[model samples]
Target: MNSVTKARYDGLADWYDDRFVTGAEPHQPGLLELLGEGSGPCLDIGCGTGRNFETIRASGREVVGLDYSSDQLRLARTRTDGPLMVGDAAALPFPDESFDTVMVMWVSTDVDDFGAVVREAARVLRPGGVFVEYGVHPCFNGPHVVYNEDGGRTAHPTYRQSGWHEPAPWWGEDGIRRQIGMSHVPLADYLNAFLTAGLTVQRFIEPEGPPVPHSLAVRATKPA
Candidate 1:
């Protein structure tokens, strides 16, 4: 993880917790659906403020939450007694095949190398283990897209652009993107990261919401 990214999240930890404390985040239902009834030990990468701790634990899976920001993990303590650590998603401090399930939620845009993070997630996952990725839909969301007043989105020709982008004027003044900007990963690059990590894609979903789908979820597994 980038130090700047860590600092950004650290500063926003409190605001972020308060903003989503209601647990009504739109992408959550689909995230849980793709997560399925968890099994064995699970790793919740980028588990900001432990938002998904209850859902993951509800399935009887023991979860270890990890994030790049210590401040984020500090707040996560209040949500769950589960083990929380300050760590990089791209270089997980764990042994090979250490987890039966690995899930990363809303972290792609924050990481410097999304592919490297996926590779690390795959490395820690045991054979036949499941890997879940749920986050903003790359094709329809990101700096390349402009949201209009009528609930319509105009995707600019910059869909192929990948990397950190300046905050767009359309972004909410109080939004996370406006605060720290965003990194854009084109649709193909986003999906290719899993394939390159030797994960077999099982399911891909564009969850229902808004005039255009804002989020996506993917379920994959390491070959047994």
Candidate 2:
């Protein structure tokens, strides 16, 4: 994780937590469905403020949350007694094959290298272990796409421009991207991370919502 990203999250932890206190973000159901009832021990990368804790635990998985921001982890501590840590997603602090399931949620935009993070998630996963990714739909959601008042979207020429982007005027003043900035990964690059990590893609989902789907979910597994 980039130090700047870590600091940005740390500073916004309280605000972020309060913003999602109900944990009813529209995409949560899709994320949990894609996550399924996988066996534990599960590792939640970029587990911000424990938003997914209740649902994940309800599925009977023994979950461990990890994030790069200490302040975020501090708030997470309130949501679950399960272990939580401040660590880099690209370099997880665990032994190889240490987990039965590994998940990354809404984290791709925050990491410097999404592929490296996926590789690390694969590294810590046991054979046949599940890997889940649930986040913004790269093709339609990003700095390059502008959401209009008519519930339509406009794609800008910068859609192919991948990497860290400064906040643009189009971004909502109080939105996450405006607050911490974001990294863009083209649609192919987003899906290729799993294939590159040698995982079998089992399911791909574009959850139904809004005029254009704003979220995506994927489920994969390591070869047994």
RMSD of 1: 1.6
Instruction: Residues 1-224, candidate 1: write the lDDT tens digits.
Output: 57878978877888888887545663366767777786667899999888888778876688799999898888889978778898999999999999999998888889889999999999999999989998889988887888788988989877787988877777778877887678989998999999999999999999877868888889999999
lDDT of 2 by residue, 1-224 (tens): 66978878887888888786545663375667777786667899988888888768866798799999998888889989999998999899999999988989888788889999999999999998989988878988988788899888888888888888867778888887888888898999998998999999999999877868888889999999
The TM-scores of all predictions, comma-separated, are 0.95, 0.95
Off by over 4 Å in 2: 21-27
C-alpha lDDT (0 to 100) for residue 29 of candidate 1: 66
Please give the distance, in angstroms, between residue 27's alpha carbon in candidate 2 and its true position after superposition: 7.9
